[model samples]
Structure formats: C-alpha cells, structure tokens
Target: MHRRQNVRRALLLVSFLLFPVTFYYLSPYLIIMGAGERTASGSMVVFGVMTLTALVLGRLFCGWVCPAGGLTEALFAVQNRKANNRRNWTRWLVWVPWIAVIILVTLRAGGIQRVDILYQTDHGISLTTASGMGPYIIFYAVLALIFVLSLTAGRRGFCHHTCWMAPFMMIGRGVRNTFRLPAVQLSADTPSCVGCYACTSACPMSLEVQAMVLSQRMENSECILCGTCVDVCPHNVIRYEFGRPRSTNPVRPEKP
Candidate 1:
C-alpha cells in the first residue's frame, strides 16, 4: 500500500471520530446549526468546518472520513472474512435506503406529526416531540433495522441498499468524478498476477473488483473508494484510476 493512501485513511478516521464524538456531542441535533435554529454552542463553527472539508475533499469525506461510512467498512470487513454465503438480491436491496430517506424527508417537510413522548433528551438536545407515532419513527426504525441487518448480511447492506445519503453522494460523485476514480485497472503483467481476489473481498461496497481486473472498467458508480483493495493487494495489480484514458499511458495522479 502506498504511504499517501495510508495517511489519507488515517486522516479519514480522525475526521470521523471528531464528527460523532466532538461535533455531535457538542450539537446533537444536526439541523440546529445552519439547518435550523442556532442553539448548538459550536454548531456554526463545526458546521462551517465540516462544510469546508466536504467542499474541498468532495465525496472523499464519505469514503474516508465519515463515521457512518466507517461503520459500514467495519461490518463489511467482518462479513468478508467470516461469512461464506453470498446473496444475489440486488435491485430493491441496493436502493432501499434512498427510497426510505426520500419518504422520511418528505414527511418531515410536510409537517408529519411526530410522537416523541417516551424518549428522554440526551445531551445537546433542545427540543422534543412525541414519538411512537409518526412517519419519522418509521424512518428511524427502518434505519436501525437495516444497520442490524448489515451485521448479518455483510458489506454495508444498509449503505448499499437504503442510505439516501449514499445515493446522493454516489450521484454527485458519478457526475463530477469527485470521489474515487472509477474502475479497477489490472497491471500489464498477467503471469505476475497471482489472481488473489483480495481486492474484491476487501471492498466495503462489495464491488466486483476481481471481474473489473479483466475488463478494466467498473460497472457501478456506488464505489466509495475506501482503498481496502489497494491495501490488501500483494501483487498490486488492481489500481484505482480514471477509467482507462483515451491515450495508452495516461498518468492519473493517485487520490489523497
């Protein structure tokens, strides 16, 4: 693995830690910052920094820094090593989060009544509503359930299937090429290639990197660019690059 990739991974982990711990602790209600009321003490500062980070790094924030992504990566890692069965269900399984978020956000915007009476306020919580009765509750339940499923199904099942945020990021990354370069390119030397499927297995998104080695193009835009494959490769045959450039030997700079 390249030193820069390792450094980027470290930076990502650090940033993710700050978000849920420092940032979220300081301001539990995410919308309180700029999304709505300014009750969070350091909400503005944290929000500003996070926004700037996202703007500068683009989808790299999610792939490398986001704690939510970290959870998926961890789950996938466990699933890759321990689980043997591979499920083929794709369509609905992959896009469930996107649909759920759309519905949840729509209801929230529409002023769907929330029942939050049972829940006690955690730190940094300024507002409370009745729970146990609302579209929002359904969203919360679904997200939680999907996360649990991720433990069993493996490879960020919720991220791949239901995260509305994933689809949003994936779309932008796809259109602007803001995230990881698309596709896994195989090195020229075939005999040197040991044909280990570590890259495919390491992928948190469960992408088909082994297959892409032969074709030299990724079929999906859902790749998060965590570089687990790059880290695992012994032969270093699989490399993340902009899809094979027009020129024969296009030199794409490695992502930080």
Candidate 2:
C-alpha cells in the first residue's frame, strides 16, 4: 500500500473503533430536537466545533476522523464502484427543511434557556446509558440507512447525499471561501499530471481530480482531503496547502 493509503487507513480504523462512543456527539436528530429545550445536547457543542473547524480545515475531519467516512471506506472492499455525482444536490432538499424545522421548533420553545451539553446522552456516552429499545431502534435505523446508501452509491453515499452533518461544515467552508479566509485545501499542478489519470481513479469520493487540476480549481466541496492524490501521484503534482494557494503553474519548478 502507498504511504498515504496506509496513513488514511490507520485514521479510518481509529475512527471506526471509536464510533460507538462518538455517535451521540455527531447525532443530528439529537441536536435538532434538543434545540427546543432548556438544556442543550452534546451534538450542539459538536456542531459548533465542526462548523468552526470547517472554517479552517474544510472537511478534513471527514477524511481523517469521521466514523461514517471510515465505514464507507471499509465497505469499499465489498463494493468499490464509483458514485454517481449527479443528484448530489438532493442532500440540500433534506438539509434546508431540517434547518427550518429546527429554527421553528426552537422559536416555539422560546429559544435556549440554558446549556446542559449533556442532554439525552448518558454520561456523555451512548452505549452504557440506554436501557430501552427506542434508542436501539434509532441506532439500527441509522446503521441500516448508511449501509444501504453506501451499497447503492458504491462509496460513502450517505456522506454525499444524505448526511445531515455535512451541510453545517459545507456552510462554514462556503463562508470561508466567501471571505477568502486562510483555509486548508489541496492545490495541484495540472501540467505535471503525466496524463496517467491515476488521481481520478484513486479518489474515494469519485471526483474527477484530473479535471479539477486542469481547470485550476482544485477545491471541491466533496473533497475530504484524504491526500490520496498527494500520495499516489507519480510526479507529486498536488499538495495540501493552508491559506491562499498560488492557484497557478501546474509544472514543478526546475532546479538551477
């Protein structure tokens, strides 16, 4: 395996192992429903952190630490087909209404009264606190939806089209872009691509990385910055950068 592949796999495995404890922190339903309450949920705190981090790192969390991301990559052994990029916009259909409802519910409940940060979560962990079948039902449903979607889309389909968590990070990344803030992203050198088409095939997100390089628009909202291209490139034509990428010169500079 390539170095980047190994590194990513290690990260993926760790996140997967930690998922049982981390699920509630990333729960969208908990955050939204708890929005109309006196005490806030852990998901809300995580949401705030995620959006803020997206402002600096884009979706690096997805590439490096998300449990769903880890699971999606793990399932690649079972179904490695590329995803259909079309209709990715459908996620927005779910996202907009969800946010609207959250806002409405909070308003109906009269804004936040206090911050509990531990609401609903059992001892700030999930596995030990639940004693009923309702939580189990929701847990299994979430797992079923993720696996079913991944099977259909061939790669992290839920992340692309159904994840309720992605929109907040996306919104933060958009804000970063709009303000031209110092953000971590990938920059590429298209002229040095070697025409091998390796990057595109290697992309787990099913992105046309070659096209992004050629067009000089290296940033993609769906890019997890897993560094697969950076690892696989024979010519080392792409790299991860923080803040104001040069946005030019696909060829590497020759030594004098």
Candidate 3:
C-alpha cells in the first residue's frame, strides 16, 4: 500500500470502532464522544466538523480518513484483477433502502405523515441528515457489498461511482482549490512515459491516468486521492508535493 492508503486504513479502523460505540454507548446521533443527547445537539457538531474538514482539505478526508472508503479499498484488493468485469446485483438490493430513506425524509421534511412501511422502530425520524438508520444500514450494506465485490471486482467500484459521501466532499473540493494538501504530481518529464497505461489501469476510480499524463490538464475532479497513479508510475515522473496551488496551466499534474 502507498502512504495515503496507509493513512486511510488507520482512519477506517478508528471510524469503525467509533461508529458502533457512538451509536450504542454515546448519542444515538454519535456527535461527540459523550452520553446520549437527543435532538441535533451533539450530532450537529460532528457533522459540522466533517463538513468543515471537506471545505478546507479538498476531499482529502474521503481518500485518507473515511471508513467507507477504506472498506471499498479493501474490497478492491481481494481480486487484484478484472474487478470491473463483475457487477454487484446486491447494490440494487441496497437501492430499496436508499429510495425508502429519500422518500421518508422528503415526506418528513415536507410535513407529511408516513406509514412506516419499510422501517419499523420506536425511533420516528428523518434518515438523510440524521445519524440514525440513514447511515447505519447504508454503512453496513456498503461494507458488505465492498467485500463481496472485492471477491470479483478487485477495485473500489462502489466508491468510484456511487459513494453518497462524494457529493458532499466534492462540493468542498470544488470551491476550495485554493488550499491544496499533499498529493502525487506529474512532472514535466512525463513525455518519457511509455504509454504502458499502468497508472490508468491501476486507478480504482478508472481515471484515465495515461491521458492525464499526456494532456497534463490535471482535470481530475473525480479523483479520490487513492495514489494509484503514484504507485504505478515506473518512470519516476510522478512526484508528491505539499500545499501547492491549483493551476490554470494545462501542464498541471493530476493528484491522487
């Protein structure tokens, strides 16, 4: 694994431990590391922190700190080859919950009374913004699917195209390009690249790394900062830098 990947693993372990403990032992919302406090009291604080982190760090948290991301990465590692050839029918199974949550939340937000057909719990509430079943079942299902998919797909398929968290983080990454963090960079010497397409194929996100090398447009909004390109670069052309500026220069390198 690369350095950023190692960081992601560490964050994943901590997040996994934290999620259950927070839900059962701490608040139902799992805001602070404290006892249960109803309403959005502490949970809002946690949400605030995550939102703020994204705004400042340009999706760095997604690649290096999210448990869901870590689980997906692990799933991709299982097959090590031809992971994309497989598809998870189980993802369709998950859509039931996803749509149900969206409907229930929309209803609740619009002040419509719900019959509770799909979910049964004393906890009557919205799922989308809440720290309840909105995330709980979704998180579990995503984890399981990642593992199952890994046996076939061998790459971060779920995260690349379908992560719910991506929209939130991308919002931050879009406007906050001014604050760059450490990332792998392509060098001016990239012309020496032999078009092996190793970097592109290595990318769990399916980003066209070879094209990014040639055009140097660095237009990598979909990049999850997984460092696949850096690891696959044989020419020693890919480099890492800390706190660089976003470039109007087409020669600018793609990160992660």
Candidate 4:
C-alpha cells in the first residue's frame, strides 16, 4: 500500500512538473475562449476524454494524474486537515455556469467551426514559449490560489470546492451509476470489518468509509477509487471490485 502511494505521488509530481506543456489542455477558460471563436480546443477534447474515462474508471484522473491535485496533495504536510466533503456540491456552481457560457458562446458562434488542439499554445508549450509575463502571471496566480486553498481549507480543498473539471467526470460517474454499468468501484465485506476507522482516517477525500461500509454501500460519487481505504484496511474488508454493483441488504451495526 505504501509503495502504491509512493508511485501515485511520483506520477502526480511528474504531471505537475509537466504542467507547463499540458496546462492549455486542461484549461477551462481556454475551452470557453475556443467556443467563442468556433474552435474545438484541446481542452475540449481532453475534458471529453476525462468524462469518457470516468464512465469506466471513476475519477482516477483526479486521484492519480491531475497536476493541480498533485500540487495540492504535495502540500498535505503543511496542512493535513480533511476538507469538508459536504461542500463538494459547491463546485457545480462554478462548473454549471462555465459550461453554460461555453454552450452559449458556441451557439452564438454557429457552433465549433474547427478543431485546434494547439489553441493559444506556441508549438504546444504553455509557458516556456510564451510571449510575455502574462502566462507566467496567470500560472503562478493559479498556483497561489491552489496553495491558499490547500493551506486554509484543508487537504484537496480545491478539488472538493472549486475544480471546474471535476463536475464533468462526476456527471459521467453519475451516468455509470444510473445505468448500473460495470465499472471500477469499491466493495465492502461488512461482516469482516472490525470497526477500526483506519480507512476513514486514511482517505484523502475524507469520506466516512467506515460508516459506508457499515451501511453496505461503498458506492460514493466522491470516491476517487484511489484505493486508500482498500489498502489501509487491516482485515482487507474493503477491496476494489470492477463489475456491476450487486444489491446488498443494508447491514445495520449493533449498538455499542
């Protein structure tokens, strides 16, 4: 489990280091700007791919590959407090309006007229080949915001409350759940659980895994399938199960 986390952290760090080349591909604003010009930007393509990926893998991108996620989690040492997951819905406020504007502008521009995977990028690089301090300023401003949110709000605070990209993948996860599609998900062997809250404590998303396991429902929209709960359980009570969700009788815990 530790090795797995190390590998995940390494991948996240690499992704962050490469953000200079990949930023435009994940830029929410770039997508909107592209729509206004009737161009299907790289961000549009990347977001579409993220949504499709979530249909099968959940938010593995956020857990394993997002540069911003990497940057935020790297600061866990400075502030390891768990975020208020109840505020996860707050991101929709940002995503919905941004999506609406993109659609509105796209329609106003007669829809996407062309595909520009390199939209606004100089030879496919975001920072190194930039013309002036504008890109650097925006990049650092974004980093500063992520830094503040992580330090003040808690671990993965940006992910929980402000990520515009998360909603796209979340919607895809919702579709997969609504259709009962076979996909990567956590399964709990409720009877095997020993009531230890290690899984809950280890969860980066701050989900109540112990409670969810006791309830016999491991499916959570916010679950990134990061496998922290699966890895941390001493009794192996939680495990990754990739298949259609099986109906289970709710397991109500006995009173202490």
> Listing every candidate in turn, what is its Cα RMSD in Å to the true structure after a full C-alpha superposition?
9.1, 3.0, 8.8, 1.6
Writing each residue's lDDT as its tens digit, candidate 2 over 126-152 gives 656453787767777888888999999
Give stretches of model 2 more than 4 Å off: 245-256
lDDT of 2 at 228: 90
lDDT of 3 by residue, 1-256 (tens): 5676566577766765454433332122232212121223333344445556665555666666666566665555455554342343434454446545544554555533322211322253323344655567855664576566555445666654344445555655555564554333334245566777878777766667777766754536566665657776777655544444435334433443
Each model's lDDT comes to 0.48, 0.81, 0.52, 0.88
Model 3, runs deviating above 4 Å: 1-19, 22-38, 41-44, 80-139, 145-154, 178-189, 243-256
The stretch of ten residues in a row with the least summed lDDT in candidate 1 is 31-40
Q: How well does candidate 1 score on lDDT at residue 153?
A: 61
Using TM-score, rank the candidates from best to worst: 4, 2, 3, 1
Model 1 C-alpha lDDT per residue in residues 129-213, reported as the tens digit of each score = 4323543454445446556767866666655544434444445444444443433322322234455777776666677666555
lDDT: the better of candidates 2 and 4: 4
Candidate 1 overall Cα lDDT vs. reference?
A: 0.48
Steric clashes per prediction: 11, 0, 3, 0
Q: How displaced is residue 205 in candidate 2, in Å?
A: 0.8
Candidate 3's displacement at residue 185, Å, is: 7.3
Model 4 agreement with the true structure over 127-149: per-residue lDDT tens digits? 78445888788888888888998
Ten-residue stretch with the least lDDT total in model 4:
247-256
